[model samples]
Target: MLHGIDLRLPRGRWTAVVGPNGAGKTTLLKALAHLLPHEGSVRLLGREAAAWRPRERARALAWLGQAEAGAEDLLARDVVMLGRLPHQDWLGVPSPADHAAVDAAMSETQCQAWRDRALGQLSGGERQRVLLARALAVGAPLLLMDEPLAHLDPPHQADWIALVRRHVARGGTAVSVLHEISLALQADDVLVLQAGRLLHHGPSRDPATHRALEAVFDHRIAVHAVGSQFVALPQLQLGSDSNSLATSPSED
Candidate 1:
């Protein structure tokens, strides 16, 4: 059970959810998107999130899950086109509008060149871009992604970051659950979680935010400003001679 997760994501900005494993970061995103049931108020676009219709909610909020699972045998473009399912008729034929949206999504994610390739044949990074294209096809105002950078190369990961920036630049809102602290620092806002509770939620530049982030991951990690970016490094632990000798085997 997550307790005290009262976070407010600002409009037209990117917010990164950071925490150690089992910190409820994924759960928090799911709950905010109404993909998971939870207690407390969750307002999306000034409406109580729970009150929105399933179809309406889907078109208003897009979700890219950790695995992006489904019909792996499908072609990359077909998988991307699946994002249009929310807007299709009972027959689900792609309308001209649908095609335009799909084209735009593919172009934005840079997957247009690989549109005809089978999803299974794509590299891990390629598949992630395709999945992002699928999410963008929804054309939602709010996008929630869980580990969207999984299996991506540095260049593609940077591409994903740029895509997110473009989306938010165009009046979209995004919340992502990410483990990469360095990339997370690029977001406009940060939400730190620890043991199913909110550790801090505010602008990423706040000193308190950095301190709380450092504390939650333990003092072992330090957050420092490098140029205009904040990066985290793992601190080394020193062992005392007494403790080391105590574990030595007894002499025969």
Candidate 2:
């Protein structure tokens, strides 16, 4: 349902999609991926996204969606091997290149240690990392993820950021829908949506971007600077009386 939206995401960078619930963030990604029908045009790498053949598109973009489901009996390595399907023939034979890519991706995501573990036996965070490895194994120029931090703890979330940074640094592009405002702020650019409309799109540090983000949230949240990074905090509402127990100075 998004409208009046026009964005040209840069290559070799990260663009984070942020918005309140029902803001159509996921819809936007689906549209860009050609998974949904939309009126407007979506161009990837200078060509219409829909113009590419399905297998060609699959080779060009890697996707990691929220709540990825897989067979519980499958081992982690087998799941990761699925990312190489685009390069495989109809029989899905793994080539030497595919094996190397999977190996590297597993090592990068730190999933190699559990490569033989059944996906059902892994913890949520562990499973998340394995899924991320699968996405990375695709070796596509662009990667799209929805709520990729779903089951990751704080440290692993940070690790995810670092992994994406490394990817972009190596000339890869990443677009992700992130609920964590602080993590979103780490992206090179931010696309803020509100109720199916494009509210703002700009560098994350731009003052205008911060203002639009605050306004979209109805001023209930405030963006602050902690050292070099930005943090979003809940705006505390104080009583007009100015002497409420919550606000009153406490005696030792």
Candidate 3:
């Protein structure tokens, strides 16, 4: 349902997409990846999206969806290896490079410990890490992840952030849909969407981006600087007056 949208993602950087529920964040990601049908043309790597062959597109763009269903029967390692499909010959066995990629991804996500287990047997957080590893195994320059932090503990979520930072530093581009405003603000840039429209796209530190974020959420949250980071705090409306209930000590 997005309208009149035109975006140019910066190369070799991370962009976080944020908005309230049903704001077309997920739909935007899907359209960018060409996973769903859309009216306007989507160009990837400066080429028309539809013109790229399926395998070529798959190798260029890796996807991790929100709570994807029905891979429970597969072993964790096997699931991650699926990301190597684009590089392997049809019906061929996994190559050394493929195995290496899978191993490295699992290790990066700290899921190698349970690589032998089936997806159905793991905890929510564990499965999330495995799926994250799967996405990483793709080794695509552009990654599109929807709600990648789901079910991760605080430590793992921090680890995810660090991983993304490293990916960008190493010259990869990534776009993610995130509900965690603090983490979203950590991204190099933030793209704000609302009611099927693009509200803002700019550096996360930009005051204008902060304003758009606050406005889109109906000012229920306040954005403030905490140390070197910008955080969104809830505003408790008390009659005619409003006060932030979650402001950090430093920002207070």
Residue ranges of candidate 2 with Cα displaced over 4 Å: 238-252
Q: Per-residue lDDT tens digits of candidate 1, residues 67-127?
A: 8666768998899888998899878689999999999999988889989989988888889
Off by over 4 Å in 3: 239-252
TM-score of each model, in listed order: 0.92, 0.93, 0.94
lDDT (Cα, 0-100) at 39 in candidate 2: 94
Clash list (residue pairs), candidate 1? none
Index of the highest-TM-score prediction: 3
Least accurate stretch of 10 residues (summed lDDT) in model 3? 243-252
lDDT of 3 by residue, 1-252 (tens): 898888999889899999988899999999999999999889998899999999999999999998887478899999999999999999999999999999999999999999999999999999999999999999999999999999999999999999998898899999999988988999999999998899999999999999998898888788999998999987765554355334322110
lDDT by candidate, in order shown: 0.86, 0.89, 0.91
Two-way lDDT contest, 1 vs 2, winner: 2
Greater TM-score among 1 and 3 belongs to: 3
lDDT for each residue of candidate 2 in 71-127, tens digit (9 for 90 to 100): 998999999999999889999689999999999999988889999999999999999
